[model samples]
Target: MELLIKWLSIALSSSVKFFAGPLLGKVYNLPWWQTAICSFLGMMVAVILFSTVARAFFHKYMKGLFNRNERRITPNKRRMVRIWNKFGISGIAFLTPILLTPIGGSIVAISFGTHPMKIIGYMAVSAAFWAIVASIGIYFIPFNFH
Candidate 1:
């Protein structure tokens, strides 16, 4: 029961913030492989939920809230567009685990009209890769903060 709780905590935190997975895993002393899988699953859950269900919900209920013609182009949006133009979905996926929350990344992808499957695929790959990388880093590397 305690073990399940720890894993669930890691997964829940990872869903909101990818970096928290590794940190929580380290705190809980879980195996690196388990940490990696949990982290990947957590982020993927958010990505899938937002990319599919949330997108549908937005289109149905909040479509009128985002009138493209009336929307102002903020600097943040400009930067996102620049990145999208330069690297497309791959770039977004690459940055998602490191920079953006899973929900945030999914919303960005959906806003740019990325297909749901494509969002899932790219996010899955990114989450798996980063989960492994972060788990290894947190588990194996000893950081002595003074």
Candidate 2:
């Protein structure tokens, strides 16, 4: 139970900040590869939770929190829709992690009518790649010790 809570917190934290890779890595005290894997897993869990359960809940109970101009960017939506129509799930999965936080990216992908499975697969891959790269970069970069 405690472990589940900890992992859930990590997922939520990573979902809120796409850049939480390093923070999570440190907290888990994970080596570079493990950190990358855990971060990616956390992000994937977040995407799934947001797209299914949280999305409906937010729409029903916390709509105001997500109601913003950002959500209604018509031109951007059109562009995203076009891209989604053309590239299908791959485009959204590839783009979401780079372009938005896990929750926000998943929301946009869902709004664009992306298939949930594709969104999950692609976003998971993208998140894994980025987390690995970020984790390695952070772990390897040397800072001068004063």
Question: Considering every candidate listed, which one attains the maximal lDDT?
Answer: 1
1-146 per-residue lDDT for model 1 (tens digits): 99888888899899999999888898888899999999998999999999999999877887777765787889978888999999999999999887789999999998888999999999999999999999999888886433
Clashes of each: 0, 0
What TM-score does candidate 1 reach?
0.92
- Per-prediction RMSD in angstroms? 1.8, 5.1
TM-scores for candidates 1 onward, in order: 0.92, 0.67
- lDDT per residue, candidate 2, 58-90, as tens digits? 568766655665665587767777877898777
Minimal lDDT window, size 10, model 1: 137-146
Q: Give candidate 2 regions above 4 Å deviation.
A: 1-10, 24-29, 54-86, 143-146
lDDT of candidates 1 onward, in order: 0.91, 0.71
Scored by TM-score, the top model is 1
The collision pairs in model 1 are none
